[model samples]
Target: MITAKNPVHAALFLVLAFFSAGGIWMLLHAEFLAIALVMVYVGAVMVLFLFVVMMLDINLERIRQGFWSYLPIGALIGILMLAEMVVVLGSRYFGLEHVPQPAEFPAGYSNTKELGRLLYTDYVYPFELASIVLLVAMIAAVALTLRKRKSVKALDPAKQIAVKRDDRVRIVSMDAEKK
Candidate 1:
């Protein structure tokens, strides 16, 4: 997805990746996360992303021209990330011996219930902070895109309110003509 040349193709590939990750999460018994990944990320977010990508008037040639120049730096970052992942996954702290097994839950126990409890009780502040950040981002996006262009004709409420009856209606005396 990252390597996809076309932005739309990249978005589609990302959707595929989300679906795959959701499947992996389902396999790991994280049903809430898996469903949220598929429904929120894949269904809603990806659709909006694809719409934005398609609507954008992008110069593909210009974008591709810089790819070769930035390749080395991108490769370096990718390699570093992969190395970090390997180190974390292969470290002794995360090894089978060091990792504690999950406690056995009764059939009535719901992971979703536990997740909701943790989210609302333990991690409420961080979750609310994240929501605030998202709200600010949304407002910022709107403010940034809302430009006052001279070409666009807009009504002024003050001017409209100040108008009198004569300003809108013109009366002229004329001789009546018979047709």
Candidate 2:
């Protein structure tokens, strides 16, 4: 996956990763997450990326120039992640016997319902905070993107609506030019 020269190939690998993740979610019985993964990554994001990659004239050599320079840091992060995973999974340091377990689900228990309940109850504050953060981000984006460009002529609706006939046109009496 590393050293993919073309953006298209990189996008294809991303799509493959998304599909694999979706399949993993399915195996975990998370229908909503799996479906969302498929819809968002496979259906929308990947398609958009493919179109962008195909349409835009990209300078691959320029992008690849700093690859080697950045590799060390990336390799360091990868190693740290690997170490963390090894600590979490490959080691029995924090065995299940030491941790408290939740009550077993009832026979007809639905993951969706449980998730909803947890979201509205235990995780409500964090969820609300996330929504507020997203709202602020959206407002900030709008404020940033919506610049009053001095070069472009912009009309105000109130000014246009309040216009009188004299404000727009005037009848003038001038000597006619006869050839």
Query: Which candidate ranks first by TM-score, i.e. highest?
Result: 2
Please give the CA lDDT of all the candidate structures. 0.89, 0.86
Measured with C-alpha atoms, the lDDT of residue 103 in candidate 1 is 62
Candidate 1 lDDT trough over 10 residues, lowest sum? 95-104
Pairs clashing within candidate 2: none
- In model 1, the clashing pairs are none
Name the TM-score of candidate 1: 0.71
Measured by TM-score, how close is model 2 to the native structure? 0.77
Per-prediction TM-score to the true structure, in the order listed: 0.71, 0.77
Total backbone collisions, model 2: 0
| Residue-by-residue lDDT tens digits, candidate 1, 12-115 | 99999999999988766678999998999988999999999999999989888888899899999999999998888788886545532346556677779989
